[model samples]
Target: MFDIRLRIPSWHRLHSFLGLGASLFFAFMFLTGTLLVFAPELDWLRYSEVRASPQGSAKLSLGTIYDAAARARPDWDIVTLVRSEGAWFADQVTGVRPEGRDAFLWVNPYTGQVNGETSSFTIHAALLRLHEALFIPGRLGKLVVTVFAIPLTATVIAGLFLYRRFWTGFFRWPRFSSRSRAWLSDLHRLIAVWSLVFFVPLVVTSLWYMVETVGLNAPATPANRTVARDQLLPPDFNGARLDAASAIAAATLPGLEVRKVILPRRPAQPIVFQGDHTAVLVRPRANAVYFHPESLEVLGAHRGEDLSLHQRIAEAADPIHFGTWGGLPTRILWGLFGVGLTALAVIGIIIHAKRVGIMQQKIAGASARSGFARVWRGMGPWGLGGWLSVGLVVTGLALLTRNFLGA
Candidate 1:
């Protein structure tokens, strides 16, 4: 059933429907996403050290960062600190706050200094929200984006069909001296040809990402974890001791360093510690060691990297979406993609507008020749419906992509 929808130029029809409503918002998303493509460079410009990963270089133990955080908020549980592009930022969770305060503080890669507290993550964050759902609260954002994606995909496909004469139309520049409409079509086609090269890959990747992130195949948790998988690191549930800490270190955590020990505030939970493998870049990289809460005794360890294949792929969507793997080169590519796409959208409409004017002129001339009776008869069922269907879908697709995919 779904495959049947793909047979027609459905994406094109969708573009027309959503484009009119969301043109402005999508333009904003495109511009911001484009600029953000160089965010690592931008962040480097803002903060100097680019100190490259928080694994081995430790003066800032998880304990110390936790301590610093404990001092600052005193009442929040650490909700996993993000280690990305060599910078450490905390996403500490607080109890009373309605919206968790995004307490972004820099950690000393070597010194363990938790520096700077700021409430202004908005500069980098606002556009992110608008990019996703225009900041709509819930399922509305999801539904709108999904609907948009179909058309966006369609527009690109239809665009290729609509402009089938690639070579002749590809490089032709608009004559400024010509009528405004003539110029608009020329300009539109020119921009579309150029931008489409970069825009298509980016748009398709983004489409895959949108569907992937909201998908169901996440990593299996501890309950579903297997012995073959967990052997690399023992499970740490505070359930039983992995012998004692030193003994467990000898048996379970061989060849790796115990970077930081997360002391437990509760007896029932385990004292969790992570492993450091400076060598393997793609290794699950962090492993959990469980210990008795009171004795600080090692219980068992779990290898975070050893997950089922589908789970690993599912986990990759966020990094892929953020372009974290290929690093700066990826960002630059995506950044250019954003710019090219915005140009396409703007130029797409201009071309559409120009063609409509030409069609109108032709229709009027045909009316004169055929008389109103014949013209009306032609328009009666098929002619009007064709224009309406094509226009509606094309415009709809644009808006939906902007609202959902672009977001």
Candidate 2:
């Protein structure tokens, strides 16, 4: 039977209580995701060095950028070969490794512009795992991430309610004198109110992923090659050819910097790929692709603003969380929300510690009377039942895996 007398208060509920013990990790991820909204613009600022030229139109051709990258940094892998656009300058990384670093760079395909180098920070990836998925590894990681998503959703709901409960707490912040209780309430209420705006998108967007990937709809997205990469080469080059690759390589971005390149798959197929930094895909100013890999031809192109609705919303995920989507205002909102959640996570631990301490004292002080003993026994079955359910799930999965392998 449930322990009615020992019921958990709604106000005392934590994300962990809602099965999102790891919600903080995603919270952190959600925060940084907003920053990624302007990754293209930000990349330019973070990695490139700019200078005003004679304001010319044409820069070096695409060949120049690719060659510069390969020659300037021979040891680095070419994850991408950028061709600059008008007034942008022809620039590319020229040298880099992608696995552990930021993999950031910029080039002006016009003037053969060059930028400095930087990689993803160790702290960034580590904290990212800590926030979005709790750094869980393999299949187990998926389960943990899924479980945490539950409480994270609940926390958002509860946060809204809690915010309402403490709405008035903000008005008096500037004038009120500081003390332990006053400060705590002040901190909670103020952050909660401000946090509501930014976190709403985080919850809504991440929740979409959860519903799509983990809920009843998982099968809807199973991959079947969204499109075939038509590849054609000399029969010697397998079933592929290189029609556009050579021409595209020789092409120039006119006067702008070529942010990225989207080339059709090689050997030979009926498609083409081109990339840009400013466009958002269906959302424009975001990203995606278009192609007919068979003929090695340019069928169509997708820029940031030229994406479809579903694609736009989907693309919004990174920008929504990182602050890149809405430009400065929206990005700032996300940043504030992320910082606020971090603070919320910290305060959450304190509240739980206090409650746990109180509970321990109460349990210790209880007399060894028959009535208390009887009460404790009643709660045992509930705890035991939960444990058994978990055991059954574990066993069932193991057996299923073994049987599948045997078959």
Candidate 3:
């Protein structure tokens, strides 16, 4: 039923070595990734009351929602208005207060009622920062995370070649009665094979993100250079501007469900409506309609289908990375797989360390200890488990301090 092979390929060794060396980073990614799956749900915990949907047959227009937000915080500058999830048609206004504090307010799209305001600092945001950038300061953190992706991608590629019998062992599981090493080995291989499809795509998407972030294939046009969403161009319009609701209603694609409406505060800037099709797995901003802010005339529109091959691949990265393409169930599945990958990394490290310990013992001719004892000692006081434990505690404390304790 199974082929007994004693020989391991060079790629297998390389894969194991890379995974072991990068186990902590991989673990961190996995842990944060699992948290990110329910990021929106986590936000609800912080804004339970504000996030609640109002019951009504008729929906209030975006103009009313904007008016409500303006009424609530007349002094604050509105940076963006995001369409909130669920049937309530709530809009989240994120902007800066005159005193310079970041402000976040919610408005019911149906009743034009202010749902309440909250600080911009959220648990979801913090965890996402950790996941995306590893808490390193600025783009450097993102660069560090991206740098680690190179090795991660290599590990996945090596694994594909290293475990050639993956298909054959697809249904196998670690034996409960086996020795620790045997059980771990079996479990590691089982996870590696079973998760190949998801693992490979995730790594590829990660690489794609890194490439995009570093501007490898960025659009050549000077106008196409992306601007940070929070960075505001000073408003030149002191007079009343055209309403966003009317502009979006007129400009949006027939099937496009608007997810965000970005207003233009400066001269010559367009009001952009970003949305997705009703189809599953489609990402927000998969299609966008840009309108002349004053004239309410369509300036330009870009749909996912209109992208070139390379651009399509680049655009597809986010949806695939977050598993948002398939909705909630897929997100849950990806979360579970993330956990398994983390566990696999731990197992891989332990197995490699154990083997290294045996080799060290043989070379040293030391009989002071044997088996797992030797392995444990070889791992030293701040070994894999020790480092991981410390990391977890520190991460928890950092997040708790920043969020709950306001450190």
Candidate 4:
């Protein structure tokens, strides 16, 4: 009989290979994700135009704000209006500016004044693109990013198995007085044990992303009606009827607090009021009311409570993955854990280098050829492929940045 153990690769080696292979990508993901957790606050700090002072308990009508935004950029086609959650936040109005570039205008809900405009290519938006697709265009980029989840999941599982009784490491601190490798090992285990909580959800959600991207377990397409060309809002439309439409939506969904108003720019698209109901983890888009473009009549409505089980899970993924369910406090906790995970990836490489004698070789003034050999040997089996993948992604990102900056 053949021994199964002989066929299976060593978990220790597999774990190292997987971790080392994807270390750079893992660092990129964690860093960008952590920043995205507080992207709104970061944008607020970076752009003064997004800041506003609350005038009173009530805000100006949505139509008035819409008119103000349209008046501010008469040449542009208004697309969407995102209501601000905080008293000091300015409502955002997105429009298609000349040359087809998207522009974001801040509208003060109280004063109905267009505060200022900013390009859609904000720092946070660029970070989001990098995080989601590494600047690779189309579904290919998304698939490439999602595929890494498999190795990440395997690494986490292998880590748990390798470090048996990982629970014991929870209270243990790194031994600073010990040798470099010893302390590094201790620190790696300590961080890995503590970050399991974050890793579990991250891997799970990442796998879900992969599944959805591959067309498996995809969320149901929202039901919306198409209208005729004549029914579309004209170029000179003043949005005078948006307030009545909003009132109709509020009455249609009694508890819905509208968060976004998706204006129709094309001929067939309908106006959409995306909002939140009483559902705890579902996104605002999950609970929405669609309206006819010309008549402003209610076309359809979706409530979070009415979603299918798969749909509900899909809707909850974003909030859970980003730690947005509990708002700022949870986001802060997630960011801290993310930083710890990022450090683990960096430290894992250092520990591997030290273990393989690369550090000592370099310290002893080893020849360039020997150093290169040692570095190559440290990669194990999966390292080369991982680096090649990273190289391709980096090339794509560099080209994308060049074109974007040049444009």
Candidate 5:
């Protein structure tokens, strides 16, 4: 009789254990990250009752929108007016109905009407907090997330090494069988192989954020300081005297799509129109044109293309991590693929637990048959050595990536 039971390797068990241990937390991350893909749309749904329908007519000026928002919430401090697929204004955390929460006001761009106001306590905002910091307080929460990135990357790498058969098999689907463990194994392997390409960018970029966050090393961004003018505007001015439309018209760059119009808060501060161009695929806010609030004179212009390589890569990380670089299609794909990571974690746990139970049974039976005190060990010194080797490899790879890519 030929026995064809699949024999799991020692390193394979180690990797599976690593993933299984972190399965629950990683699953939370995956689910929350998926929701964050459409965060803006989901957040807007929280205020759908008062949301204004899009009008076909000409939109109101940014100045008008700011005034309407200010009038709607007299106590609120209007900070920025954003013109996206929709028009909205954000105010500093004014603690209105929801005490200690930031507020966002949606405006009817055509008529300068304050259409809707939403607070920071919405489900979307909570999910974002969870995704970024696990709802933990302050920098400590960020550190918790940053610390986990390395171990998570190690698990992914170990999984890749264990599945070497994938390349040789040309990614063949494991044959379907009535065996439950075999079926799950096949499915797991299939998803793991397909997901490896995306896993690299996901983990590497994540590690980059973690490293930067802990202040081990961080990417440098070009300094931007608001240039103050000696000539002051009228002290009694109630709002921005120059409108956003005129400022944008005077300062818009070639081939850039206007995304947001930021009205200056102080007299010396400039009205900035920020947007994206096809050249910079990373951040949608890659291009900027600044205009003096009173004079409407061009103060400065900045482009993402002008940034240094390291700065550009750092900026690109956000869009790549969020899968926003390629628009809605890419975001959907990222969300879908993110589910596979969760599945790998879950299935790895199940498989490891089942294997542990089987091993215990085998050890018990062997002890009964041999009557030997220590004869029934599941794995000997060889397995311990294999685990040590795997650990060393993971550590080396992570450090190499951090030093080279980050530096």
Candidate 6:
């Protein structure tokens, strides 16, 4: 009889190696992601100027707001005006300054006053960059981050396989009176079992990101008509037609709540009115209307309902992954689970370290004489080498990205 067990790799060792190898990176991502869940609110809390009194309705027109932003920053080329979702939130007007850097001005819709300004590198932007690419620059960084989905998915499967009866552990509590290792293991399993709901969707969305990053499952975009150079608006255009264009957009798409107004920057660009309609899970940009830059004439419109199946799924990915589909409650739930995932990584590391310490205590020969040799023995040659390699690669990539961005 063939010994099938002999050919199979040790699932326990594989699980530990996979989990440990990416645990630090996973913790970092989880922390940053959790912060991003309430990024807007964080900024609102930090910057008092972004806060506004709850007005029943907007007192000023979109054109007035645009003019106010332009007057506030005369040197900048106003690019977008994002409408506030809440009455107490200030509308955002973003513009490109010299050297192509963006500046955001918070304008009170009720008064058309520019409350304050911030650079493009706000806390949210910095955290998003770190979460998406670890600040490693272009497509390469994105690919590197997305590729981790493979190991992460594998680790989850291996974990579930190791604890085949994970469902039974849902109601089980960790024994506080037990040894530290035993309690830690119990807590780890308990958290993992409870977090299965979040983990499944997280893994699915992460894999989708990997697919998209590699250009495998590209989503279809609406075909845009190019504007001629001769049709471009003059530099001194005051955006007086913005109010009329917005009204036209609202009439074009019934029930459309315009969230963002993207202004044209170049001759071949159109003013874009991006918003949400009755679409359930799609993004604001999913439903949009385009207009001629100078004429304010309707060019085309895209309904969220008109999206293909693949495109709908792609559109839903971010909302699902970030738990934004359900508003505040889901975001809170996602943040809690994110903390749980972070704890799992930390607990897994502690558990492994304790186990390794026990193994080292039993080895009392010359091989464990020096601190380096002891660490080598404790982690094993492969484990130490893998950690070292990851550290070096991450450091090098960070430096390279910094230099690239600087240049």
Q: Evaluated with lDDT, which candidate comes out highest?
A: 4
TM values, all candidates: 0.57, 0.57, 0.79, 0.91, 0.74, 0.89
Candidate 3 C-alpha RMSD relative to the actual structure: 5.7
Please provide, for model 1 over 1-407, each residue's C-alpha lDDT reduced to its tens digit, 9 standing for 90 to 100: 36864666554444453443344445555665676666545554565333334455544434455445556554443433434434443322112222544345445544555554443342345445545654556656544554555555665666676677755776687888998867876776676677666556546646655665466435444531222331222334221332245346545756545544444333244545555533222223345566554445556665546656555555454445555456568667667667766775665555455555456667755433332323222322544523543454444446545544433
Better of 3 and 4 by TM-score: 4
* Cα RMSD (angstroms) for every candidate in the order listed: 10.1, 10.1, 5.7, 3.0, 9.5, 3.2
Question: Over the stretch 1-407, how does candidate 3's per-residue lDDT look in tens digits?
Answer: 56545455588667865666567668767878888877877877767545656675666556666767877887887767887656633567887788777767978777777878877776677777777775656666566567768888888878778877679888887886977877888899898887887887788888887887686763521122233334343344221342544455444677776778776554445667777764334456657777554445676776777656666676677778877767678888888888888888778877876676667768866555554454344333435633553464466447546555552
C-alpha lDDT score of every prediction, in listed order = 0.50, 0.46, 0.68, 0.82, 0.62, 0.80
After superposing candidate 4, which stretches have Cα over 4 Å from the reference?
1-8, 217-219, 234-239, 358-376, 381-383
C-alpha lDDT of candidate 5 relative to the true structure:
0.62
Q: Write the residue-wise lDDT of candidate 5 on 328-360 in tens digits.
A: 788888888888877876665555555555565
The best candidate by TM-score is 4
Steric overlap count per candidate: 36, 90, 1, 0, 0, 0
Question: Which candidate, 4 or 6, would have the higher lDDT against the true structure?
Answer: 4
The per-residue C-alpha lDDT of model 4 at residue 124 equals 69
Question: What TM-score should be assigned to candidate 3?
Answer: 0.79
**Which of the two, 1 or 6, has more TM-score?**
6
List candidate 1 stretches off by more than 4 Å.
Answer: 1-25, 35-64, 67-78, 86-102, 165-220, 223-305, 357-407
Model 5 bad stretches (over 4 Å): 1-10, 49-52, 56-61, 86-101, 110-112, 168-171, 174-176, 216-252, 264-269, 365-407
The parts of candidate 2 lying over 4 Å away from their true place are: 1-16, 19-63, 73-79, 82-143, 162-170, 174-178, 215-259, 264-296, 302-309, 354-407
Query: Candidate 1 deviates by what RMSD?
Result: 10.1
Over the stretch 1-407, how does candidate 4's per-residue lDDT look in tens digits? 98988987888988988887777778778887888877888888999988899987687777888899878898888889998777888899999987887889999888987889987776667767777877778888878888999999999998987898999999999999999989999999999999999899999999998988888764674758675686357555566788888889889999888889988777888899988788889889988999887777788888988889898889888898999888778889998998998899888877876777755665776544443344455565645855665685686579568746954
List the pairs of residues colliding in candidate 5: none
Candidate 6 lDDT by residue in tens digits, 315-387: 9889999999998899999999999998998788778776666676787762334433333333435556347
- Ordered by lDDT, highest first, the candidates read 4, 6, 3, 5, 1, 2
Worst 10 residues of 6 by lDDT: 366-375
Residue 349 displacement (Å), model 4: 0.5
